[model samples]
Target: MYGDWSDAPRSLATLGYEPPIPGLIGSSQAMMEVYNLTRRVAGSNASVLLLGETGVGKEMIASAVHRLSQRAAGPFVKVNCGALSESLLESELFGHMRGAFTGAVSNRTGRFEAAHGGSIFLDEINSTSLHLQVKLLRVLQEREFERVGDTQTIRVDTRVVAASNRDLMDEVEAERFREDLYWRLNVVPIRIPPLRERREDIPELVAHFLNVYSETNERHVVHIQREAMEALQDHDWPGNVRELQNYVERAVVLAESDELTVDLLPPEIRSGTKRPPLGMSAQAFDLDTLTQEVVQQGLNEADPDAEDLHSRVVNRVEKELIAQVMQACSGVQTKAATRLGINRNTLHKKLKEYDLDS
Candidate 1:
């Protein structure tokens, strides 16, 4: 059994790395509000629930909060609730004593216990089963728990921070999540805007990713072409920053020169003329030109890639874009077909055509 937790508050200044509190990458008011909320709630113990689409950087915000909090000196544990099964997740969070189950051979300290005097980040908390949620609720309420197959109670003083990419309210309404638990976890809700909603931030995020990856890859790519920037800012980034990061990394690796031109962008993005109608202006269209410009700008410091590798990369980009559009439409054959600008019957044939739907 663990001893009682000390309630003394620690000073944030003692922590070496101050919270790199996410700032407004854009001047947009929505992003500014998000930054302000993150800064304001950084020092609190209240459970924070980050709501956003995938790749919006909820985990980054969570880390910033932990770094700024009074418990900065202690462990910052993270668990992906959606990644584990119910039984495994229970043991992972609350732990199990030796011989607690068939696979349990020794005593274990779960995320909660490991996070004592610190913070535990529960990613995709909505994925937890009701039974597991009850246990979690108990821990949140009592700050105490017992290992599986052990009656001895263990007390912890871990601050909880949970995040989800799904619509939690919709989940609750569908009986897929516990309402009470949702309320408890939502003490300080932080909503991250999707990339499409904050398209203005594309330039800044692009610059940041470019600089980081270029140095890491020993490249000196310094500029972006105007048409390339336009393509980047115009496309609806359904995958958000993550997609952008992948593009930059790929660009750095395959860059023929020190510039990041649109040619480095995936085929779907480069083929701006083929982009599905997003209710945007057609005057901005010029996929190939944009690609050439951006690729030229970022290839200055990057190594040249062989023709075969470049061809393979183009194919990979095509595959990924197709997959993303299908997923965004939730595997709905017709909608996905429409999004991809193909006939429904052709999409049905393509499902088997690409061996994807199977």
Candidate 2:
């Protein structure tokens, strides 16, 4: 799901100093490709659509493209489409004349006019209603729109950069989004991969955030222990880079020394544990035989000369089995009992008798 630097074009490594894309992290081949695509499409006037889950930094990439583009000198405006109601959103995008509605106290310029000769980033554009979508489609097609409660059409020149966490195509298929609007915004599609897909970049991102937070919070923290780093790398960051940035900031603020250690990490991270899939092992089919062999070894160590083989075997296997089930269930005794095909109280009694309660 991630591109290793090894997979990137070898020529890029040797290319004479071109300043790295500002504020956009791209150590992996996947991100480097995004950077390259951004540069390639920067000069064009075509609308761009950035697609990814939340916190994947679609806005940052959009900024990069604008910075490198001819519109670098123009203002960069942004609006969260999903954050406003349909009526308010229309006024926001297309402006409204005085007394356009109950709250329209004065004539207002829309985001389009504010972003003239610049760029307007419509984040979460997929959440717009069909009526709003029609208006957006008209703007994209004619580059002219009428202010609410005004018959005059105002012309504006601005590049549109729309982003969505949802797949616009899927939304269209479900009849929730307009296909024409989808095609209009998706003139140049860019998908930002989630953080978990780029684990190779975690160490660098951690270090970057560590320095940032340390300076901002006046912390002396300068290094992350290898164990702590391994835990960070192994985590599945559902919130992407934003989550990583926040976590590193939290650790830095909580740090008592110059280095981060596993002791300061969250329990899940420090444990680095997950449930093992059922019946998955090196020899899945031979589990019963292996279990018997391990039980026999434990029994011999407990009592080598015991004449009552059945009792000794039963006691040893039961204790070991209970302990293993408890561990695999993460100390949930009820689940352990279910896995063991026994009642919860029976498991509790066994735990007390064998002194494996912990």
Q: Assess the local accuracy of residue 108 in candidate 2 as a C-alpha lDDT between 0 and 100.
A: 96
Tens-digit lDDT track of model 1 for 27-116: 455676776677678677788999998888888888878877899899999999999999999999999999999999999988899999
What is the lDDT, from 0 to 100, of the residue 277 in candidate 1? 30
TM-scores, all models, native as reference? 0.71, 0.72
TM-score of candidate 1 to 2 decimals? 0.71
Error of 1 at 179 (Å): 1.0
Clashing pairs in 2: none
Looking at model 1, report the run of 10 residues with the lowest lDDT sum: 1-10
- For model 2, what is the C-alpha lDDT against the true structure? 0.83
Regions of candidate 1 where Cα sits further than 4 Å from its true position: 1-27, 273-358
Judged by whole-model lDDT over C-alpha atoms, candidate 1 comes out at 0.78
Query: How much is the lDDT of residue 185 in candidate 2?
Result: 91
Q: Write the residue-wise lDDT of candidate 2 on 320-357 in tens digits.
A: 77877777655666657877899989889999999998
Task: Pick the lDDT winner.
Answer: 2
The top-ranked prediction according to TM-score is 2
